[model samples]
Target chain A: MLPFARVTVIGLGLIGSSILRATRSAMPTVRLTGYDVDPEVRGIADRIGLADDIADSAGAAVIDADLVILCVPVGAMGAVAAALADDLPADAIVSDVGGSKESVIAALRSALPEATIVPGHPVAGTEFSGPEAGFATLFRGRWCILTPDDATPEAATVRVRDFWEKLGANVETMTARHHDLVLAVTSHVPHLIAYSIVGTASDLEDVTQSEVIKYSAGGFRDFTRIAASDPTMWRDVFLNNREAVLEILQRLTEDVTMLQRAIRWGDGDALLDLFTRTRAIRRSIVEQGQDDAAPDFGRAHE
Target chain B: MLPFARVTVIGLGLIGSSILRATRSAMPTVRLTGYDVDPEVRGIADRIGLADDIADSAGAAVIDADLVILCVPVGAMGAVAAALADDLPADAIVSDVGGSKESVIAALRSALPEATIVPGHPVAGTEFSGPEAGFATLFRGRWCILTPDDATPEAATVRVRDFWEKLGANVETMTARHHDLVLAVTSHVPHLIAYSIVGTASDLEDVTQSEVIKYSAGGFRDFTRIAASDPTMWRDVFLNNREAVLEILQRLTEDVTMLQRAIRWGDGDALLDLFTRTRAIRRSIVEQGQDDAAPDFGRAHE
Candidate 1:
């Protein structure tokens, strides 16, 4: 149904390895190859049979592959692209799984001069990373956002869309800038807010600090999960997607300040109104199935 | 190990019913009586045998209660206290399970002029509500802050402390004002922020809104659970504990704003530093066994 006969996924981190596993399972006839700059990750993938074969280098992995996916951190896209630029098959479709699209496109395009690159982001992930953290169902019911700048060909874009669609992702296209902006509001800013709040609580004196942890199930524990995401990858995300995250953060800050004043001034109406208004949004999310009616956390046993 | 002959629990909500269930199992010899304004809640408690006996009215329940715990919302504390005020035995010690201690203390003090009143708060709960939402283990290994103002006699305070200790809650004491302020920072502000963000995400246009829910696992869903809390109860919390909530909320807003600016300016160092600093708090929480180290969420089957 699709043109990709030999697909090579580089960087067997959560996203890369997941794509490799899913593609392998769904497109059984197509040959799948994998590579990770980290030898240990490649070894693990080989041992688990996540790929048909594991390659030693990026160039070797993509040499004859018809589809090449850059699944490494957003910051590493450029170097990986450059390393494989010379050996990629002429019509190979190059795509990625980066959170921030603008920087990813800029970096990858500069290195791979002739590939049919369809810049995309699967708005799906877990807090865990590396090959073992991935499973085939990771992409089920998630969104795969395609950011096809002017350089991407229509045919290649369609093919990329089809690939993700078959993978069970609801695919949509938007400009790179808008993707970053919306995500800044929906994901990045929220994450930064979580990190900041957790940091603030951590700064409390030792005795109070221990109590905060002891009673975290009250609310603070939720923030800690987001704050505990892979530090290096998150650090790179903030660095690359700074502008959009900052903009949303600014608006959130102002809103929070207004709330702070209301609390300080003992304004019950303001507090109740906001709390009530926010509860409605949660109801909407539940109606949409984004959240389970059961407890939203501690799903490890599943 | 505790001295109470009969313990009456008023308003069998999540916390109240939990206290009764825990007490029933811990002090099998002590008579546990329960009363709730909600007929269904009372029915559930009766069916579950959470108490030795059930009463239709607060006064009827408190008549012989050596220990009476008012577990209604902070706003309703006054009315509940007043209703049972004249009936409380002279030697009866009254307490409460309100999130905001100051308001609960002020209400009960004015109502029961002849009874010994000592205010307390158990800093633990689940997102679920009603009698069905409680368990004996809810208070196990949790902290219970006992705010016995200067008027409470040492002997009375010690008895109250012993009761909580026997129920498996680690007990500590703080002034009513201090307890309210500390909880406002560690719990209330975080909840408000979660609700606000979830609300904002809900307000997004239809297309973007669907994506918000679909990809909610990124970070937004955590806020949804916190926001999904009992609306009326939360509304009361913000209303009754307005002062301290507002104060801590003010500090949080400032912190969120600073982070926003860092993102806007593409300040990687700022983002990285904040992210790294926040990781320590999570580590502390994990070390304290307040949270788990696994992918703390997404384990739906459990």
Candidate 2:
């Protein structure tokens, strides 16, 4: 393990708190400082001992730290970076766990010009948010994708990649643009569609509304879990990653319309072909160990 | 429990096998007969002791039975009903488990003119299909909706309702049109969207296509589970429930576009409000015991 020396993490949401917990577990000797605007979350982090020190301000957290990780929503990256820009020691390896890469890199680069910023995204989280929801094993066996276009120093990228490796995440590097496009299809557009479907179900006539909830098992339950994600965070992800999301949405709309036509025309072969092809990807995800077999039926056990 | 003198089930898919298993456990005295176009499926059902008898054809199954249940694809309801119409014993309570109610009712009513048709749907199933995928408790504590019209005989409807209740299901009655419309939003559209999203992800350029599956937990995994459902069955559902699904899809598309615009404008409030409302519905579904928490993620472990 290449010693992180002193590491600072900003924000204590699901991703932020998870990073703090994982870092503490993996590197007990490394000094860790955490800062979150939410005082209750900060206290939870302290009580749980996720960080060795709790910093009152961003500057207090970044000063003399060898590495700084922006674990906030993509929308807040710029402001957080600007706050700690002057306090960040020169050559501090800066990285992030933001969902969207392009906007984060652009925002952080404008603020922390002196720091070597290596944009990263840990493709892991639960519906729950804040410090209490975090666990040390959140990133275990998951992927932590890093996107560092031309300007990022190779040494800084390597350090951030190594840090992710210690947290039990497989590390891979890609271009910021590619990351944005891929995530738009994988995460952003899917989230938007989920939010939309759930919203539609919620608006049904009162009697049907209850039945919608009652019979959600048919398929609607899955969308609700995706829709349950922190609204502000998802909103920021979509806003920061607008063009890519819209592009993917356009493609999705075309595909949906085509499926609709197949249904209208009673083309079972077309429908079966499309549906069958999608199942292979699910098998791949299962083989890759991204999902488990026990489906949470959205109920508390009796 | 009211005795089922003789119960006939057509099509030995997941829902059919499940109802058969449930019936066997609930009413051991009831003589159960099953028929499917695929003789292999019937052989499996017989081998697994899922039914007391296996019929060679739909006509052979319904003859002399007190209750005949059409459990084929939604699109196949008419053909199955027509085939058995002449052979169905007089005064027999004919019901179906088609995902779409309106079409099922209309087709059965037109075909089985002399029979008491009480259309129904058990709002429960798994991604896996076939007789081997079923369990005796598949319908236990789940909603079994009956959509019989005003003209249907009360005794027939009550008998159908009682059958589901004996199998440990909570039975409710509503208009077939209403059931179709509500399910359009809650089930049909969601399945279509999930299938479309998975299809889009699969079509992505090779490198990204693989990563999308690898990192599916970030929300795409849920879509995959829904998309991975039996293609033939879903294709039939869409074709048979075309009008209601299309109507809901149009509304969903408009709602999705609005959310897309909100994301573009960085309207966190709009996104947050919708997200919060959708979360409440999911909670309500859990409270009603219709869904499980993190259901998609748990499928991996199962």
DockQ of each: 0.49, 0.56
Residue pairs with backbone overlap in model 1: A246-B264, A263-B246, A264-B246, A299-B299, A300-B299
Deviation (Å) of A204 in candidate 2 = 3.4
Residues B105-177 of candidate 2 have per-residue lDDT tens digits of 8888888777788899998887777888777888887888999887788878888888999998889898888
Q: In candidate 2, what are the lDDT values of residues A71-96, reduced to their tens digit?
A: 88889999999988878888688889
Model 1 TM:
0.90
- The weakest ten consecutive residues by lDDT in model 2 chain B span B293-302
lDDT of 1 by residue, A241-268 (tens): 8877766665665666676666566666
Q: In candidate 2 chain A, what residue range of length 10 has the lowest lDDT sum? A: A293-302
Q: CA shift at B170, candidate 1, in angstroms? A: 3.2
Tell me the native contact fraction for each prediction.
0.56, 0.68
User: How big a share of the true inter-chain contacts is recovered in candidate 1?
Assistant: 0.56
| Predictions in order: chain A TM-score | 0.95, 0.95
